[model samples]
Each structure stands twice: as C-alpha cells, then as structure tokens.
Target: MLIDTHSHIYTEDFSEDIADVIQRAYENEVRKIVLPNIDSSSVKKMLNLTEQYPQICYPLMGLHPTSVTEDYEDELQLVEFWLQKQKFYGIGEIGIDLYWDKTFIKEQTDAFRRQIRLAVKYDLPIVVHFRESFDEVITVLKEEMQPGLTGVFHSFSGTLEQAQQVVELGFMLGVNGVVTFKNSGMDKVIEKVDPSHIILETDSPYLTPVPFRGKRNESSYLVYVAQKVAELHQISVHELARLSSNNAERLFRI
Candidate 1:
C-alpha cells in the first residue's frame, strides 16, 4: 500500500474530475491520501472531500505558512476552532515561507510558533512547510523540540546538514517529486539519510515527476518517486514502497 502524505486535491484544479483522479490513485496502488488544509477558505472543501472518501482520505487542519498575513491571528483562531471540534490526524502544512513574499515574515513566524504550541497541546504531529527559511524553522524547532513535538518537514529541499538537524529534532524529511528532478540536489542528501527517517509524497496537482514534468501531478505518479528512491538505494521499487509507506504509517499513525 502507498500513502501520499501531502496533496491538495481540493484545489480547484481537480474539481472537474476529482473522482477520476482518485480512481487513478487507487488503481495505481495508492491506498491512503492525507489532505493538508491551506487556510480558512480550504477547510470546508477539505472536510467535504474527507467526508466523500473517509476510508481513503484523512484530513489535517492548520494554517499554512504562506497563508499567514497581517490578519493571521484571525486565521489561527479559525484553525483552532476546527481543530477543537474535530479529530484531525495532525497540525500542519505549517512552517515559514519566505519564497513568495517576505512582507509578512514576522507574522508568519508568530503564527507558525502558535500552531506548533497547538500541536503540542493537542498531541499531534506537525507537517511543516519550509521554503528559504530552513534556518529559522530549525531554530524554532530546536527551541520547541521535546517529547511529543514530532512532525515531518514537508517537501524537504535542504542540505544534508539540515536534513540531519531535522532528524535530530525527531522529524522526518518528506520526499516528493522534487527528488526525481535532475536539477534537484535532493539526490545527494537523500543518499545519506536513512530511509526510516523519510516519507514519500507527491504534493500532487503541483510537482509532477520527470517525463511528466511541468504537467499536472497526481497521486498515481508517486510510483516515479518510488522508482527514483529505489535506484538511489539500489533496491527494488517494492522495497522502497514498503519502507516509505511503513515510515508514513508510523509517522501519521494511519
């Protein structure tokens, strides 16, 4: 069985053929998918998707870093409200993102920290989104790292040192289609990290794998990522799938 740890199938991009997309995923051996909420606007859609496919789709509630802004406090409140009323699997798609716009940097940090505290309070794993702010994210995690403060660094694109730091902090590095890109340095770093500390994801409708690069990605394409990891470790695709899927199941308690 395969588990796509991060995917935004709720995005309008798949609204026209969501059932077909999901069917493709199952046909390709993807047994479970975890949908991470972006913000207040996406919460309802995410919940509805989970309701439609409860056995296969699990929902996570949290404020995405990029969604943080001057009015972030209100958004955080909304996240908290939903989290309190539901049994979400985790608290995430949260972290710091300075790639798109750094105007709300401070607000993003505050919101990330607040959400981290919430994860601790609720005893849930965090799915982090770090972009051009690895140092800052590591610093926060270092200060907050403790028993029960574990999570995955989603779409990890950092150095071996950074990956080591994250592992040291009790977090898994979320490997995705980026690992299949020829230009991505993930190949080198992933060679050093243990597969036990890694999880597979497609981040579908976003980072499609090679041969399908620049096109719409989907959960079914996760096999390409599995193939790449197998080649890197000189193992078979089945072994990579088993190890990676096991890692995801352990981390997410699926």
Candidate 2:
C-alpha cells in the first residue's frame, strides 16, 4: 500500500472525472490520499471528497499561505470554526510562499505560527507547504517548537542541512514528483536523509513526475515517485511503499 500525504483532487481540475481519477489511483496501488484544504472556498469540496471516499481519502483544515491577505485573521477564524466542528487528520498546506507575491509575508508568518499552535492544541500533525520562504518557515517552526509539535514539510525542496534540521525537529520531509525532475537535484538531498524520516506525496494536479512531466499529475503517478525514491535508497519499490506508508500512518494517525 502507498499513501499520498498531500493532494488537491477536490479542486475543479478533477470535478468532472473524479471517480475515474480515484479508480486509477487504486489500480496503481495508492491506497490512501490525504486532501489538504486550501481555504474556506475549498472546504466543502475537500470535505465532500472525504465523505465520498471515507476509506481512502482524508482531510486537513487550514488557510493556505497564498490565501493569507490583510484579512487573514478573519480567514483563520474560519479554519478554527471548522476544526471545532469536525475531526481533521492534519492542519495544513500551511506555511510561507513568496514565489507569487511577497506582499503578505508578514501576514503569512503570523498565520503560520498561529496554525502551528492550533496543531499543538489539537494534537494533530501539520502538513506544511513552504516554498521560497524556507528560512522564514523554519524560523516560526523553531519558535513554536514544542513537545507535541510535529508535522511534515510537504513538497520539501531544500538543502541537506535544512532536511536534517526538519528531521531533527521531529518532522518528515514530504517527497513528491519534484524529486523525479531530472534537474531538481532533490535526490542528492534525499540520499543523505534517513528514509525513515521521509514520506510520499504527489501534490497532484500539479507537479507531475517525468515520463509525464507536462501532464496533469494524479495520485496514480505516485508509483513513479515511489520507484525513484526506492532506487535512491537502493531498496525495492515494495519496501519503499511499506516504509513510507507506515511513516505517513504514524504521522497522520490514519
């Protein structure tokens, strides 16, 4: 079995053929897929997908970093309200992202720290999405570091030192299709990190792995990623599936 720790299948990108998409995932041995909420707008679809596949899909509650605006506090209240209403498996897709716009960097930092506290309070793992703001994200993570604080750095593409810091801080580095990109150089970083401190993710409908790099990525394509990581560790794909799936189950409690 394999687990896709991060994916946004609920987005309109899959609305017309979600059933087919999900079926393909199962056919490819992807037994579980966690759908992290993007914001208030996506909550309904995200929750609906979980309802549709309660056995295979799970949900996370949070306002994505890109959605952080001047009205972020109000937006965060929405996340809090949902958290109070239901049991989510994680608290993320949360963190800093300056790739598009840096105008809300300050707001993103505040929101990231606040959500980390919420994860601490609820005893849930955080699924972080750090982009061009790795240092910024690490700073808040360090400040909010606590005994019960733990999570995955989704789509992590940092240096070996940063990966080590995250593992040491009790978080797993979420590896995805980015690792398969011929030029990403992520394999070099993964080579030095313990496989136990890593988890599989696709971030699908986005970072499609090679052999299909320019296409719309799906959960099914995670097999290619699993194969790549397994090769990097000199292990079999079956072993990668077993170990990474176990790591995900332990972290997400699903």
Candidate 1 lDDT score at position 164: 90
Q: Tell me, by lDDT, which candidate is best.
A: 2
Model 2 spans with C-alpha error above 4 angstroms: none
Q: Kindly list the per-residue Cα lDDT of model 1 for residues 48-100, writing each as its tens digit.
A: 99999999899999999889888899999999999989889999889999999
What lDDT does each candidate get? 0.91, 0.93
Model 2: which residue pairs collide?
Answer: none
Candidate 1 to truth, TM? 0.98
Q: Against the hidden true structure, what lDDT does model 2 obtain?
A: 0.93
User: How far is 75's C-alpha from truth in model 1 (Å)?
Assistant: 0.6
Which candidate's TM-score is highest? Answer: 2
- Model 2: which ten-residue window has the lowest total lDDT? 129-138
Provide the lDDT at 134 for model 1: 94
